[model samples]
Target: MRRYGPAVLLLLTGAAILRVALFTELYLRYVQAGLRPYLVGSGFLLVLLGVAAAAVGRREREPHGEHDGHHGPRIAWLLALPALALLLFPPPALGSYSAAREAEQRAAQGIGSFPALPAGDPQALTLAEFSSRAVYDSGRSLTGRTVRLTGFVTRDDDGTWYVTRLLVSCCAADATTSKVEIREADAPPADAWVTVTGIWHPKGRLGTDGAWPPVLDAASVRRVAQPANPYERR
Candidate 1:
């Protein structure tokens, strides 16, 4: 137990941190949507399990330099799985997963509040500039025109799938997701990086929060692998 103590602690700590970070918004949105009781209970159970493991591991110790040769490497290797999974298959952005949960937030905030800019030189465009322009421009200028975009998969309430591009100024902590709905016969799996060439059509519908919603109606959608730069423009 002692031989594997550090490894277990490391795995738990890393998992807790990663889960907390990735699901922070989900947790908050769940609470805001009045579904916290169920999620909280489940989350507490996980925490209790982690605590029990830690406690048991603390009660045993390996003699100095006398490694538990059989279990040490196995434990260490198991501890490496999470990091490897993260590298190989990073989690997708919080899109439709939280779309319903955040419907109230979206309604209260409104999409028009997003910054906008007047058309100018494209060469001087930054990500912020492009995003702001894209948000405000109503996709009208680009309507019926095929444009390329890369993002992870997200699903809406109607079971409609979307390719969501998260724009981040820094890290995933502050990422804001922008989405384009895919009109395909079969939806792709969530969290898959995809490059879509689609004609943008702006339309509004009633979201779950009973607010007016605007989204890009995609003409085409396809699946692809992750890019070298998984995170979008800073």
Candidate 2:
């Protein structure tokens, strides 16, 4: 067993990767969709290498040199534990706990006119888009449009609640929060996925610190299943 430790570790790690990237949508929790193929390829290679290494180890005679009892450091086996756990039980996507801990940081965009929203009673919009238009659109494109936004719930220390979503340029490690203050309705449970339909409830002037977070006067809050890809592409 000691002689094959490296093979076992590689197999476990590859299996864990395949469990999320090949067999399920769980990989979306940590990485962008574009990375799936790379992950799948890497995992496949790892599994092949592990199998080859194990076959080589089996053919070797027992060593009797000074390192006869040593098969690398025993402590290195601990690295396999995480891979085993991930294979058995993958973790959920980042939620309210992560959102709450992040400070508000919007990318700087000049206040400008946005294209007219499509004709509809309620337009479905990403949380980031809604936030951008609400805070920086000089044309006030959202003035009369009823919009539907979906995100998990998060709350502030003052009891202010927000409908929040994370935006990621590449993966969860680089995630940033995009949120809107929900008003005229009670907040759903923290981390609960919800679709909020509302009109813009403007506060402060556009492009100012006071206008941050954006505001929505919700007409309805409906519970929804969490999306497969929880992080919006930045």
Q: Taking the tens digit of each residue's C-alpha lDDT, what string does model 2 give over 1-234?
A: 667888988898899899899999999999999999999999999899999989988987775554665477778778788888978988889998888788889998999999999998799999999999999999999998999999999988788899999999999999999999999999888999999999999899899999998999999999999999999988
What TM-score does prediction 2 earn? 0.95
True-structure RMSD, every candidate? 11.5, 1.6
Which window of ten consecutive residues has the lowest lDDT sum in model 1?
A: 205-214
**TM-score of each candidate?**
0.43, 0.95
> Model 1: per-residue lDDT, tens digit, 7-51?
455555545444533455433311232444554455556556667
Candidate 1's C-alpha runs over 4 A off are 1-135, 204-219
Alpha-carbon local distance difference test for all models: 0.49, 0.91
Question: What ranges in model 2 sit over 4 Å off?
Answer: 63-69, 73-75
lDDT for position 199 in model 2: 98
